[model samples]
Structures are given as C-alpha cells and as structure tokens.
Target: MDGLNRLPGFEILPPEAPMPMPAQDLSAAPRQVRRGTSSPPLMWLRRLLVIGGALLLTGVATAEMSLVLGLSRWSATGVVLTAIFALLSIWIALAFTSAVAGLPGLLRRSDPLRLGEQSPLPQTRTALLMPVYNEDVGQWSARLSAIRASLRAAGVVDGVDIFVLSDSTDAACRQMESDAVLALRARDGARVFYRHRSRNTGRKAGNIEEWVRRFGGSYAQFLILDADSLMEGRTILALIGGMERHADVGLIQTLPLLQGGRTLLARMQQFAGQVYGPLIAQGLAWWSGAEGNYWGHNAMIRTRAFAEAAGLPRLPGRKPFGGEILSHDFVEAALMRRAGWAIHMAPLLPGSYEQGPPSLPDLAVRDRRWCQGNLQHSAVIGAAGLHPMSRLHMLVGIAAYLSAPLWLGFLVLGLAVSFQAHFLRPEYFPATHALFPTWPIVDSERAIWVFGGTFLVLLAPKILALVAVALSTRRAFGGRMRLMVSGLVEILLSSLLSPVTMLTQARQCVDVLLGRDGGWTAQRREGEEIRLRDAFRIARGHLFLGLALTALAVAINPLLAAWMAPVLVGLVAAPWLIAWTASEEAGDRFRRWGLFLVPTEEAPSGVLLTSDTPGAGDDRAALVAAAMAG
Candidate 1:
C-alpha cells in the first residue's frame, strides 16, 4: 500500500520474508545454554549468597518470632502465623541482600559492553518494531518521529528499518495511524512501514510473531518497543553494538527508565524508578548474568535466535492460565535459553525510556492483566531444559503477585489471633490453682523489637538507594538536598500506597484464581483529571476495609490500633489519595518544590523533549482531536 492510501481498507506493510517458528514442547529437554567456564563459579557464588542469606535471615527471624510468642505457650494459631511470617520474611531478606550485593557495581558504574561516547556504528541491519493497539496516534507518531530524527542525527538511520505493526481494531485509530505514518514518511524522508492485522490473534505476541514470519529474514536484529517506549539514538546504537559483539547472545535488554510523568502518582513512580530502579536492576543483572529475562519491550533480540527458540505454544486448557501466554517475555527468554542462547541485561545503559500509569486506578487496571500473566507462569516454571535461573525468574514473577495476598493473609490471621487472645477466657486455671492466672500475653518488648526489625527490613533498601545516590549520582537528581527530599517524599507516598496496592493485587489474584480473565485492555498513557466520584467508586471497597480494620483494632486495644495505624490510614484515605494523586496540578506543585525530582525531569533527552514540541506547520487542534478520538 502507498502512503496516500488514507482509506480504512489499506495497510503500509513491507514485502513478506517468511521465517519458520515451530512450537516448543514444555516437557521435553532441549540443548542447554553453554557458557564460559569462568561464569559458573561466579554465578553459583552469587546464587549461593542470595539464597543462603535469605535462609539465614528467615531462620533468625523465625526464632525471634517464636521467642516473642513464647514457644512453650504457643497456640496453634500462633504457630501458623509464625510460619507465614517466615515465608514473607524470605522475600524481604532476598531483596535486602540483593541490594547489598549490587551496591558496588552501581558505585563503580560498570559498563559490561564498554559502549563509550564515540562508539562506532553497528555493521548489522536492524528493525525497530513497534506494535500498537488502540493507542493515541498523535502521541505515538510524534514519539516515532523523534526516534527517527534521533537515529538520523546519529547517522545510523540508513541501517535501521522502522515498522509500525498495528493490531488496532478501531477504524478511526487505524485511519489516524495511516495518516500519521504518511506524515512521518513525508516529513522525515526516511524508511517507515505500517502493517495492520484485522484479527489480533494472541494479542501482542501474535503481532510480533506475524512480523517475524513475514519480514524477520531481512533484519539481523529486531528491537521490540511498546507504544510508550522511546530510546536515544546512541542507546539504540549501543544495544546494536552489544549484540554484534556477542554472537552467542540472543537478547540484550536495556534498563528503560520512566519518563513523561505529570500526575502525582506518576512522579512518585518516576522518582522510585529513578532512585531505586538501578540498584534493583544492578543486583538482578549481577546474579542473572547471561540468563536475564526480557521485560517484553525496549529490548533488542536476534531475529534468527528468537525465531528458532522463542516461538510460543498455546498452553493446553481453558482461560486465565490456559491458551495464549499473557506474559510472553519471560517464557520466551526461557525457551531461548533452552535452545542454548544467552539473554543478558545492560542495567547501566541509559537513554531507554517509557511512561508510567498516571494514576492508582490506571495502575490497578494495568496490574490486573499483569497479575493474570504472572500467575500463568506457574504452568511454565517446570518446563524441561530451562536454566535454573530462568526457572527462578518465573518463580519470582509468580511470587511478586502472590506475595500481596500472602501479606493480607498474614495481617488478617494476626488480627484473628489478637481477637482470640482478647475475647476468649484464659485456660490457665486448668493446670493448677495458681495465685495469679497466667495472662495470654507475648513479650511486648520483644514483639516491639521484632516489629521494628521487620519494618527496618522493609525500609532498608530505600534508605540504601538514597545513600547510594548521595554518594554518586546526586547531581543528576538536582543535587543532594533535592535527592534527599525526593527520597523522603517517595518513601512516604509509597508507604501510604502500599496497603491500597496490596488489597488491589490481592483482589486481582482472587479474580485470576476464580477463572476471571483480565482481557487485553489498552493502557491510558496520558491521564485525565480523575473526578471525585470516579475515585470514590473505585476505592469504596478499600475505604470500607480500612474502616472495618480500624474499628476492630480499636475494640481490641488502642495500642493495637496504633500499631496498625499506617495501614488503617492508607485504607481510610484511599479515595482522597486516589483523587489527589491523580491531579496534574498536584504533581506540578511538587515539581516546583523540587520534590520527587528525577534526572529526566531536570535535563530531558533530545528525543524526549522533541516528542512534546510541536513541529513546523502542525495542526494542534487536529492532533488533539485525533488523540481524543482514540
């Protein structure tokens, strides 16, 4: 189809070059990924340290908890609660140790690929595949234009093919996309193609696979991007160079930082990602080494390797956990590893970017789909010939969602035991006619200590992130004072949001388990002002929950209520918090005060800045109307 074909029936895709993608079997063994002899010992040591530290921490916490509850007088309920605490503590301990393990790498600023400022252009041809659904065409097209401009500036535009692979079902959206593509081609005078599928089978995974089948043979590597993703020209080159240098590597995933946040929640997310994201990613990369998992976007992959190893088979069964894999990235990495291909993460590489959900309600909407996808990993975790690390990756993905409900259970069970202790008659008189009936009580001081320690365990990583930033990257975050203030604001906001997120995720888990499918829904990238009625409607359940917990705790004892204040407050203020944080004005107010300041906000990249800037002869009203129509 030509660029002038503005009709709804036409598409602008390239010529076909079919590549076979055979379905992989989960039960059978495939060739294992071969690595250098030096890697195993280091990999084993890192794994051992993380695993061993978690075990050690859990064991010590269990003993302390046991002591606090008085093991000699332990009720069945107390024992069960203690076991649950131990399970919860393991996740915390693992994170804490991983942060510690990764701190050195961040401080040193290690670059594994050695992609310096004057890096030479990559020799291999690459395809930049952006698969869109019902997205705002104006914003999407602008970002694409910015990317093409950045690439052209870097003198690598000749080696790259930009393809807009659309699964957009809306006719208006399709027409707008076609028009936008034509505009981009006319304006940039660059090679850009567009393809639209009438049937979005398998959703995004299917969109990509269709591209691979039709046009995969022409490109040596393909960089997969989401609708919201943008990368600097240099970062794109660095990724291509990294792939070229490592022939055995199947994929190299960049650390895509959050950008373009305008709401309070979005800025908070931006801050957390800016401050804490690197430490977490560094730790993951250190241990994961060549076995890193894909996040599905902003990552480049070898066309042949992906075609040979990452083709997905529909999980046999019904919905939710069955049929098409909702989270295809992790499974694809596993399948690639099973076929002897390495997957690596370049955590230190910068300039890769994406947008975050602008409100808590929007986040919940997005997370429901993720929760379903991660839960589906339970079926793929046992697949044969997968690397142990790959399996661990899937297990971690499953636990990430499951942990929320587990935490809720812990809270409820603890509350239940508290109720039983306060309401039930003491059984101390049965043993002997004691002068004073033994009270059903724990060591209050020890219990306080245990609680304090658990809180510290939960908060330490954030504190460590602050310390790391202060010592190294403070200037990037608008100097030390700004960084510290931003860190504090982030911690405060995150604490308030945690209970609400926990409850939301717990509900999502229940929905997924109960055979509810979180069908593929388009993400709302640019947020609107959240109305009070809308916020309250979404958060009424959380509000009711908060009130219920508050009354129950107060009835038990004021100190118990005080102990649960943070969580109770979060629940009670859910609606107001949602509405307030969804305000762009509130986010702007914080930005003025230099609170929640991220590097991207202080000094934006050229491509990112260009995305927001209007081009010459542009019709602003028309673009806004088109975007609103989507």
Candidate 2:
C-alpha cells in the first residue's frame, strides 16, 4: 500500500478540475498580496451600525440583569446569584491556580542546550518537519525561511534540517509547494528541504510517522510546526538550548499567539489573546514545569524518543468521533511523558505566531473538529495509563470544551429559578415585590453557578494574561482605560459569541459519534469577506435559545427582558454574527472604534517582529541569495 493508505484515520479529498500544478518557478507564492482596497466609509458605516447596535443593546441587558441582582434581597434572588457566584468562584480558583503555577514554570525553563553543553552528548542533527495536506506552500515556506534565517543567524544552520512534508495531491498546491521549496533552496539550499508522499495515510500524525520511519535515524531532534505556524529565531534557539539543558526532556511547546486575523470576531479574539495570554501561560508554566502540554505547534522533540514511542493505536470507534486521535499532540505529549521524557511549554517568545480564521463560521467549522478531538480523548486518558500531568491536561481540555454546554444548561436552570421565585413562588417574594420586582436575571441562586464560575476559571486567565502584559509594557498600551475597556469589550463579545461556538462543537461531537466525517480545510486569511448566509447559519440557534431564555427571564421584569434582549438576540443570529465577525468591513469598523490592532512586524527581530521596513527589500531575498550562492 502507498504510505497514505496505510494510515488508519484519513479522509480522501474530492478531485479538483484538471489544471497543471503551479510550476516549480511559481513556488515563491505571493506571501502578502494586497487583496483590495478598504470598503468605503458609507458602506462601512452601514455594517457597523448593525453589529454595534446589536452589541449596545446586549450590553444594556447585561448591565440591567446584573444590576437587578444587587438591589433585591428576595430569597430566590440570593439563591440564583449565589449559584452563579459559586460557579464563578470555582472557575476563579482554577484560573488563579493555573496562572500562578503554570505561567512561571514555562518561563523559568532550564533545559540546557545540549550541543553547547556537556561532553557525553555529541552534536546531534535535527530536522524541523512541517507537514501540509493542501495549503499555500509559498506562504508556508516564507515562514519557515524566516526560521532558517533565524537558525543561520544563531550560527546553527548546519545543525538543522527542515523538510516540508506535503500530502497535497492537487496539482496546483503541489506545484505551488515545489516552487516554494525551490525558492527556499535558492535562498537556503539543502539545509531547507521539501518532500511529498504520493498518497497521505493517517492525516497529520500519519504524515509525521512516514518521515520518522524513513529518515528518523538521521536526526537526533525534530521540530513540528503547523502549516500556518511560526516562531522567533530566538524562540527556536531557546527551545533547543532548553532541551539540551535538561537531559530528560523530550519536547518544548511554545504557546502560539495568533496573528493576521480580520473580522469583528477575529479582532475581538486577537485583542483578548494579546491581553490575557500571558497570565494563563505563566500559570500553566508554574504548575506543569517539564510536564506541560503540547499544542501541536512551534514545538521541538527528541527524534529518537518520538520514534521509540511511535505506533499510535487507531481509536476503537468508527468515522469522525473515533479512529485516529484528532487531538494527537496531547496524546503525543502523554506518550513522551509516559516514555519517561519531560514534555513542556515555553512562553510567547518573539515571532511565535499563528493565523486566526477569517470569519466566524470558518472558526466554528474548525472547532467542530477540535471538539470531536477533545471529546474522543475521554476514552483515552484513563485507558492509556498516562501520567498525572497528562491526565490533568486531558481533563482540562475536556472541561474547557464542555464548559459551553454546562453554562447553557446552567443559564436555563437559572432563568427557571428566576421565574419560580419572582412570579410563581410568591411566598419567597419579599414585601418589596409590590414596589420592585426581582429586576432581571437576578437569580442569585443560578448567577453564581453560571457567571461566577465562568468568570473565575474561564475569564480570569485572560485577565491575568492582560495584567502581566500591561504591567510589563505599560507605556506601549497607553493608560489603564484602554486596557480595561478593551478587556471588557472582548469579554462581553466573547461571552456572547461562545454560546454559538459551543453549540457548533457540540453538534460536531454528535456528528462524529454518528459516523459522519469531516476534513481539514486551509484557514482563510484575515480580511476575507464573510457571507451573510454563513454568519446567519452559525448564530441562528444561539439567538433562538437566547431569546427564549431572555423572554422567560422577563417574566419577573420587562426592563430586564429588554436589557438582555440584545444578547439573546445575538445568540439567535449567531450565524450572521459569526459571519460579520469574520468580515473585513467589520474588522475595519472595530479598528475605527478602537477595538484592536497587532504589530505588522510583531516579531522581536525585523522579519518576524516587523515585515521589511518600508524601503528595505524583502528578507526572503537575502535567504534566496544565501541558498543559491552558498
């Protein structure tokens, strides 16, 4: 059998109309082509009025609902708020626990660079493997070339080999990939390489195995990057150094701080990530130490160790939910740890980057796969006999995925309590009932269970990340108002958006269990226009549920119902909300409204940190020169 057919968990893509793959000369894929000019202001204003109006309406509801809880001493009000509070508290505890423990441990990493270290360990050759099924190869190479430049800059060019392992059967992508490799070769030559299998077997994991089985013996270390992934040259060197420093270490994963995402949702996400990523990272590092989780990107591993632990068992079930592990990185980490090797995470080093989905629907589609992947692990954790840290990672993954469902149910239960206390259970209503109703969403009993719990665990980590970044780089972010406002807006939008995401994922899990299949699609770049239909589809269900809940909530107070109406309304219009969030026009509006922005050259160094300065020629030219001339 061809290598591709041998892998158990794979989906065959449909054939495209015949066209010659881009020739090798076409390899230098357009790294960044300016698509089209900005949408006109009149057009922009039209779109913003819609989403902004929706958000403002929702915000009013949220405020009223929260305010109601503060005034009334109704017995049931206390009960609902208290429940929400309790849930929030637990979330807080988990967040604080993780941040305090996890973040530091990641940064204080002490893995010594073996090459530069002791005598017993000889200089080991390493291969950096980037496996692409169907993606922009030139775009992919441009990123890797940056890393190669970084490695060369560190003067360790000879020690590292990069292979672009492609499973793209399409003639176009194949040629595009070939062209990129040639372009890279023109710059970096043999040190940077490319390969493609006639057929792909078991998705991503299977692709890696194909290489490991063949050239596994040649390299002492191997690194993995997602097609869209990148890391600062410094981060790569630091990772190698850390691995060498710690003899027992097998892998070091850098948290991928995503970039280049447009659309309202994407911008909101980017803002949240930039603001809150650090604290959570710090917390995770402090707790996990050498036993951190692997997120499948910007990570390094011992080639020998991975090969020894190689054979991943095909899952027991059929189709989507079962077969190969969708979330293979975690299991890989677990296997490494199980094999007596330390698996770890490094902080957001400069140039470590990933792309966010262009639109909301696209992101949901992606999450569907992730939800299934994480859910499948439910059976793997205990059965595989993983280490304690690995199990925690698995459980947390499950919890984070499942939190939406739990919160949804919790919200329903809370509103039910509000209805019961304010309208139905007159006995529990205080004398003030004649003068003032329990306001809205003021169910103390359920509020704690819902909002409180979420804030503690889910939201707290982001806050922590934000605080750390702000404290360290106060001047860059301006005063606290911007940060605080940015955080609040991000949190509010995310909360509204998440219900839609959870529902999508939940359905995906169900689909997998039912034996339907899904495939990996290339992530749409930022600034892509989102379709109205796609947006509406994603948000429709959430809006319906949100409205229902809000209406029921209003049984106690019309003002509360009126207040929450926008958020509930957004839920029902989830698909549209998602689409709009992904819209470039929406993204521009967010920017105009002072929503968010990322550095063009966010990398610490010139290339990764900032794209070529206005007049400077592309750095890739230098790499091309080095590869061809050398």
Candidate 3:
C-alpha cells in the first residue's frame, strides 16, 4: 500500500534507468554538430511551388474580390473585407496546391526509405510508452495486449517492452488500471510495467520527460502512443528499422488512419481521413523530406536525440499564453532539427491506427485544448536556431486556429456591406461634374465568378483525394460508386458542420485571448448517446447565432437570406445535428447502407480482430477477481 492506492501484488514498478533531460534555452546559439541528412533540391523546389502557388492563388482571388466590390471606389469596409478574404484564401489555396503536388506520390504509394517486409529488425532495446490519463482501462489494456501479440507474432517482441504510464488521479480507476496490468504481467512477467504519478505536473509532456529522466537509459528508442493508438507489429518494427538504418534521423512520424469509428461523426472523420488524408500527408512528406513534423503519437523517436535536444522550457507569464507548452510535438521536432537531427515522415507506412472524437461536442473539446496550445506557439516561433521550415510549421499551426476568427470577421463585414447597400442611399453625382453616378454597386456577375472559384478551390483537395482512391483502391471502399456516395456524404456533412465549427473555434480563440486555460481533460472515446438537453446545452450558442444570422439576412434581402441558408440551417439545427450524429444507431444505419465504408471496417487485420475479442488482457471482471484473490 504505497499510498498510491496500488492494488495488492502490483505495488512495484520496474527499476529506473536514469538519464538526464535538461531544459533547453530558446536564446542559446545553434549547436555545431555532425552532418545530418540534407534536404534535396527537389524538396526546396516543392516548397517553392506550394508556397508560390498559394500566394498566386490568393493574390488572384483577392484581386477578383476587389474588382467585384468596385475597387476604384473601395470603401473602408470593402478594404477590410478584402484583407480578411485574402487571409482566409491563402490556407485553402495552400491545401489545394499541396494536394496537387502530393498526388503523384499518393498514386505511386512511394516508400522513400525502402522500408518493407524485408527490412531487418534492430537489436537495440525499445520501449512502447503509452501515456494514459483517466482513460478506459479495459479498452487500452486490450489494445496494448493486441499490440503485444502483434509484436510477438512479428518476432520482435523480445527486444521491445510495454510501459503503461498512468497519470490517472482517481483511486478507483488507478486500482482498476493496476488490476488490468497485474493480469497482463501475470501472463507476460517483467516485460510489462505500470507506473503512476501522484501529480500530473506538466501534463503529458511532463509525464514523458519524467519517464525519460527515470528510465530512458535502458532504451535506444521509444515509440509514443496515444491512449487510443493501436499499431500493427510490422509497422512498429519498420519504424525502428528506419531509425536504425538512418542513424542521423531523430524522429519518424506515420500517418495513422482513423479506425473503429462507430458514431456518425467518427465515421465521417474516418471516411474523410481515409479518402483525403493520404494526399495531404504525402504532400507534407514530399515538401518536408528530412525536416518533417511529429504528430505526437503513432511515431518513433530516438531516445538520446529526444533527451538531448527536445527538452522543453516553460515560457514566462501565466495561464494560456505562457507556462508549460501545450503543443509539445511540433516544438520537439523543431528543436531536434535545430540540433541537426533529421525528422522524417513515412506517409506510405501502413498499420498505424487511431480513434477519432465520437461527436462534434467531443471534437470541440479537443479543438479548444489544441487551440490554446497552438496560440501559445506565438511565443516560440521566434526562438533562435529553429529551421525555416520549422518556423513555418509553427506559423501554420497558429494560422489554423486564427483562420476561424478571420472567416467570422469576413462574414460579418460582408453582412455589414450588404446592410450598407440596402439601407444607405447611393451618392448620385457626388462629384459636381461626374459623367456618371457611382451607384455603390457590387458587380453581381463578377462576384458569382469569384464565389464559384473559391468554392472550387475549397473542394479541390477532396476531389483529388477521391480521384486518387478511385485510381488505386476503389474496391477497398466498397467500389467506385459507394466511395463516391461516401465522399458526397462526407462533403455535405462537413459543409453543414463547418459554420458551427468555425463559430466554436472562433469562440475558443477569443477564450484563449481572454486568458482562459483549456486545461487537461479526458477525451470521451466511446460514442455515448447525446440526450436532447445535453445537445441543446452544447449548441445553444450556435442556435442563437444561427437565428440572428437568419433574421439579419432576411431583413437585408431575400437574396442574402438564400445565400446564407446553408450556414443558417446548420446553426439552427446544431442540437439535432449533434445528437443525430452522436447516435450509435445512426452510425449503424449508415453502415447497413454501405455509407462511409472504410477499408479497416471492411477488412480488419489480425490485431484488430484480437482487440475485438474478450481476452484475459482486458477481461476486467476476471482481472478484478484475480487481483482481489491475490
């Protein structure tokens, strides 16, 4: 009874292997170190192409918008609207161009490092570090067991060990977690270890650093896994093999597919990720090359490199903008790159999987937390010695959240412009000797062209992703017709949900600006049903905003109202939409009709099959009884 509420017979943790992880100084000069993998000329060219293309697209779109708004007689409101539109347009343009650039890689399914089944496993010891925080014990245990089984089957389990790092504070939950691990250890012995920290301290990053300081010396590399992460053993071996083969490489990230989606929202995410994720990831990999980013989980990291280079320092100040870094992965990658260690992405790697948020509300919670983390990156973007690409990575992360507010401002300004058009009388013959009156006119025809073009750009990535799938793996998604239908469903749902998401993220940005902390909260993985009251509670703001927009649009003009119908409808129907999508029944109904059919669901791997079964690893009742008996 070590005061941790540790279950009897599972009181001891594995012996510690001390390793130093010192805090990094942002102002320190760059380290002069050994030569690492150099970024190819083509990588630089790819970056130039994507960046230049986005800028060109944004410039052209902004010029068109300016013309539509009567550029020569541009009002203050018109200028502001144009600025916001330009800001918003760049992100979408970048995405469109990036997808286009990545299409070839996606089509070819390129494996740049030549990693395959023939790759040899490393002899060095590795650890699988799964950090849990008030998560479902049974589910995670089962997943870990399946992973263990997977590794054993691959003949690499002998060199790797599994560590269940618990930040769970609940005594009962800790007991259950301990009980589950006890059962696992009973079967597997010292290969499995469970350690609990009384204080969460710096949250997940801290939990990991603590582990590094305590036990990192025992392992040459460690793979980070989210509570929901599940990897096939071969994928794990391949990542290790990559690290071993490329000694200069510090980290390697995999594009984990969203699997086990049982809610409508989750299914949509899965479908979209399966269809669209490849192009985006490939594009990233193509441009990023050796200077790639880490996505926190389903990734492998060189233990020494991380310990030596990725030590994070707390920023000066309080709450949201300062203190502990929230988005640690990006900063870690940047630091490692600064230390001249190559970071790479293996987008073509398969068998890396993760779960998605079960509902929109759940997504909002996660996004809010991430919003704070990304916004905090503003302080670190200017840190000395960071690679140019690393700086761009942080900047893009901040821009991702900022784009929501920019969109809101754009919409609001457009509404104001419309109101001005309907209410204010145009100055006819303002100049005493004017040849013709400037009618405060908006070029409706030109505006249509601009709108259509913007819409097309926004839709380009999805279309490209669909085309890539159709060309390569149509049968994987229930054939071409079903895939198309699923794509349509995903697009429609995403469009309908966009406005709500925008408002939510806009509010999150505002909250962060107001110095509110999102704090560490447990994510709801299981797709629990959303009741009407809860749905209404969650969506009241959206509902109110929707109604306000609808009224304002109608008052301004019938055409304006028609133009805003989709946004207004989504806003007004937020409650029903959230509830309906969160329903397991709705998800099942979609499944029955072959909608949102991802390959993982159609054809599960052996590990997934094992996870679905009631094994001793996660048989909670049996574990509980066994622990009590012990």
Q: List RMSD in Å for every model shown.
A: 4.6, 13.6, 4.3
User: What's model 3's lDDT at 55?
Assistant: 98
lDDT at residue 131 of model 2 (Cα atoms): 89
Model 2 per-residue lDDT tens digits across residues 178-230: 55564566653445556677866777887887777767777767889887787
Candidate 1 wrong stretches, greater than 4 Å: 1-9, 33-41, 72-74, 424-439, 614-630
Checking candidate 1 for backbone clashes, the offending pairs are none
Model 3 lDDT tens row, 8-42: 63344666789999988999846746655544457
Candidate 3 minimal-lDDT segment of 10 residues:
1-10
Kindly indicate the candidate among 2 and 3 with the higher TM-score. 3
- Sequence-dependent TM-score of model 2: 0.76
CA lDDT of every candidate = 0.84, 0.61, 0.85
lDDT value for model 3? 0.85
TM-score: the better of candidates 1 and 3? 3
Quote model 3's TM-score.
Answer: 0.94
TM-score of each: 0.93, 0.76, 0.94
